[model samples]
Target chain A: MGSVVMHNVVSVDGFIADADDEVGPLFEWYGNGDVEIGAGCTVSKTSAAYVQPMWADLGVLVIGRHLFDLTNGWEGSPPAGEHVVVVSHRPRPEGWHPEASYFFVDDVARAVAKAGELAGDRTVGVAAGDVGGQALALGLVDEVAMDVVPVVFGSGKRYFGPVDSQHLLEDPHVVVQGDRVLHLRYKVRR
Target chain B: MGSVVMHNVVSVDGFIADADDEVGPLFEWYGNGDVEIGAGCTVSKTSAAYVQPMWADLGVLVIGRHLFDLTNGWEGSPPAGEHVVVVSHRPRPEGWHPEASYFFVDDVARAVAKAGELAGDRTVGVAAGDVGGQALALGLVDEVAMDVVPVVFGSGKRYFGPVDSQHLLEDPHVVVQGDRVLHLRYKVRR
Candidate 1:
């Protein structure tokens, strides 16, 4: 079976925003790492030529209702096994997914289990809120990767969904190419 | 007197880091914004040519010890009508300033008050934190401005020390730029 992973860009401190559903400037450049996040500025560092292929590798997407909604709707579940899933109590809209399809399971283990079964030989990933913590809590996740930004968010929604010493996770690998970013990958200890 | 404003880059969830300071891969291109945050492979964005003149207009610098230590040391006190007040119970090292440049105060109020006195005709720009929040709580700080980032930290040391709400703080004058950065400015409302 392919690995079930939870990944997202995170900041220092813990909360996401000061109030409301505010997602600050994330990426300024789409093709390049120099995309803009906020208003209407175009930024680039990692070009689309380099990142376009990265999206092609994602097999299955698991996310919270919040994240699912953020994308307006996960239509066109990517090529090469881009199966989308949502973890929420809400009912799915009609024809949310067409061909490749998507799924939403309320239970954590069930969701991971379903993703695992559906992943076939591909990876299953989750995004949004405490889903990562939930997956980890249930011992469902296999790998954890994060891109660390040097900005400090003082208050809002916290991200560390559930990180207790109980997990005892180890085997950390870091990828550093820029000052404003550090990509760290980790595997669950047991 | 001077205007006390807050400027920061926060995550969507409000944290600066995950459980162990995992920021994810957001800031790979440091200079991707008109406003840059910390140590990176890029130059400080806000410190551009246009901003150089603004520095001379600054009167006081308010910062918590966490920030004070993070920047290594004070920026050699503010230009002319300025004082770099480092909020801490312990004393600061000598020679941090050229003249009677720096002040380490035990009381947030005392520090702000001295800062205000020193800020003859300029604004009291602050890198506010817990103690800075204390000053704001005590009705000293006049304004707050922050740069809201995109990602979520999930957990870490927060900005303010703590609060029960004194019914202060005005509505934020929020400006959403194309860079996905929110320039939110708040006033001390009575």
Candidate 2:
């Protein structure tokens, strides 16, 4: 069996961006500098310490059209390590990453299934917070890790909603730094 | 100047609910009880434990149509202790609440401003998850607390969205838990 993992930065007030659709400020908060805190551990070394390694492990990447546009140039695109799937009605643009094999799917489920199928024995990383929540709601995500930022977007879009009522979380693990940021993890239960 | 607070429950995966609008199911995860545990400092026997006398100071309640219906008090209306503001496009029903004042405003801003005015020296409570999140995004809520349920609602409406990213938490001043519910308190920065 294969699984998808989603990681995101959410505002303290439960928003991802402001009303202006800008998440740059939130990104800037984590982009200060990378520092190696201890053995195999680092704090704020490049946006997030966990993202780079997590992204590296993924054999497949599933992203939404909006997220695709946000990264511009397929973002860390896994450097020839991961195949990418994009869900969009829009046509692919010219001069896209050739190393990255891109497929346009019409729905979230198809996009997810394709990622799982392509992932083979490896893990599939679902990137967008919104879509990631949707995948979790659909019982597709196997695990989730969130590096929750302490800033409130003040107005934009929220990551999740008041959805179904029967879903459950197995164990909640977290590393808290007294309000600076929290890296939380949860296992999805069916 | 006014500040808003967020009280909520998120899955270890950081989901407020599943894909369905099922808050009731989320509550069952706390081990079958309604109140999870005691949190923060309690002001009264009738109030949530996390809520202090400061929250009770807010004398008004603001909510959306969905919540008003969900609570199912179309006939008796809100109690006399607090003035209730319902944000909806429909016309206000004649003599909606026998013991309290009911103002139905289409615009969110108006509803908020009027609530502030009516609340006078007291605080204003933005009711329901959806409307509560909206008010927080608009920078309307001053102090808030939520009964965080454990269920992972499968598929319906979500309480917050990436769209709700307008604001983030300033500091998590408190965390309280009951057997089936949790109470989280977050401050909104101006």
Question: Scored by CA lDDT, what does every candidate get?
Answer: 0.55, 0.58
Going through the candidates in order, their DockQ values are 0.07, 0.31
lDDT of 2 by residue, B8-106 (tens): 555432345544444554544334434423332222232344444545565666777765666644444443225778888886666666564777788
DockQ of 2: 0.31
Candidate 1 docking class? incorrect
Candidate with maximal TM-score: 2
Residues A1-190, candidate 1: write the lDDT tens digits. Answer: 7887667665433433334656453221222345542223232444223223434455777777776776655455432355777788887876665564677688777888888788787778765347877787677877765544444444454454754423433424433323234344566656
lDDT of 1 by residue, B1-190 (tens): 7576653444433433344435443332245555533233242454333234445567777777766776645466433344688788878866555575777887777877777888876877766446655765676766655544433343443444453232223434433332323334455555
Off by over 4 Å in 1: A15-18, A29-54, A76-81, A95-100, A162-171, A178-180, B1-104, B108-190
Q: What is the lDDT of residue A186 in candidate 2?
A: 61
Best by DockQ: 2
